[model samples]
Target: MSLRANLVLATCTACVLVLGAVPGTAGVAQAHAVLPKPVAYPARGQLAHQQAMDDGACYGWARQQTGVDPSRIASAPVPVIVPGGERVVGAARGAAAGAVVGAIGGDAGDGAATGAAVGAVAGGIAHRQHRRQAAALSAQMQSSNDWALSSYWQAWTACMTGRGYSVQ
Candidate 1:
């Protein structure tokens, strides 16, 4: 796996383990996305048992309407680090420039070799920068997804409130 992939996986795993150890998290098992629970009360004299049934029904209705599952979330996948072509491309560019300089100095071969190495390093640095940008984009996408889940949770709360429960 790429270094970036390993770092993200390790960070996510740590978050899951830490949250799992806390009280009243989504749960220790399958704690992918933990959502906040809105406090709810039966406003129209609903029995506790009846209220539970209504809550379950509302939960289902909200999920169906929004198509966002509270129990599990399928977030967008992170970008993969593809390895290829950069070194050769950089070397080719470097060699062309180096040959021109070296022909004037009477040492084209040595100049070309030096230029290729420098160009390869520069290309690698640029590639690393791109990988960082991709990781940032992945994070932004996940944040947007979290907003969607919050909306789904709100929908569930709305459903519960509509069914004679005071949800806050």
Candidate 2:
């Protein structure tokens, strides 16, 4: 095979691999969250009603003061584990390349099949490593976001406490 043919084969293989690896966003499921129950305040009669009103007002005020969206409190983001697409693409490409090389030995089909299997395993390993790195970064980002959220929660709780409602 000419150098041009080899380059074309390599290019096509790479294109297939890259395109296959891209993730699709359609049909993603939304996560459901269980919100914390409201704290019960001790009060009686007319005082109980007043306390209820206070709790309602204070909760709203705290949310606004802390700039925390209620929806965010309801639903936290979940990280997704991506499936590898590179394995199939790699195997296909490897087989094509192998066959071309094996043509000189008059056993192109056997060489292609063997090459494909090896390429697939290598691709799977590469995919695993990529996912590991992505998961680590995702965890770090989640930790940072959790800290910020906790800071907001603390501030909100403080505001409610200052409003004369015993906050737990």
Cα lDDT of model 2 by residue, 48-159, tens digit: 7776676667567766776765457446575555656666666777787778777877767666765666666676667667677667766665665555556555665665
RMSD, candidate 2, Å: 7.9
Question: What TM-score does model 1 achieve against the real structure?
Answer: 0.51
Shift in Å, residue 79, candidate 1: 4.8
Task: Tell how far residue 13 is off in model 1, in angstroms.
Answer: 35
Provide the lDDT at 28 for model 1: 14
The number of the candidate with the highest TM-score is 2
lDDT of 2 at 34: 32
In order of appearance, the predictions have TM-scores of 0.51, 0.62
lDDT values for all models: 0.63, 0.60
Say what the RMSD of model 1 is: 13.3
**Local distance difference test, candidate 2:** 0.60
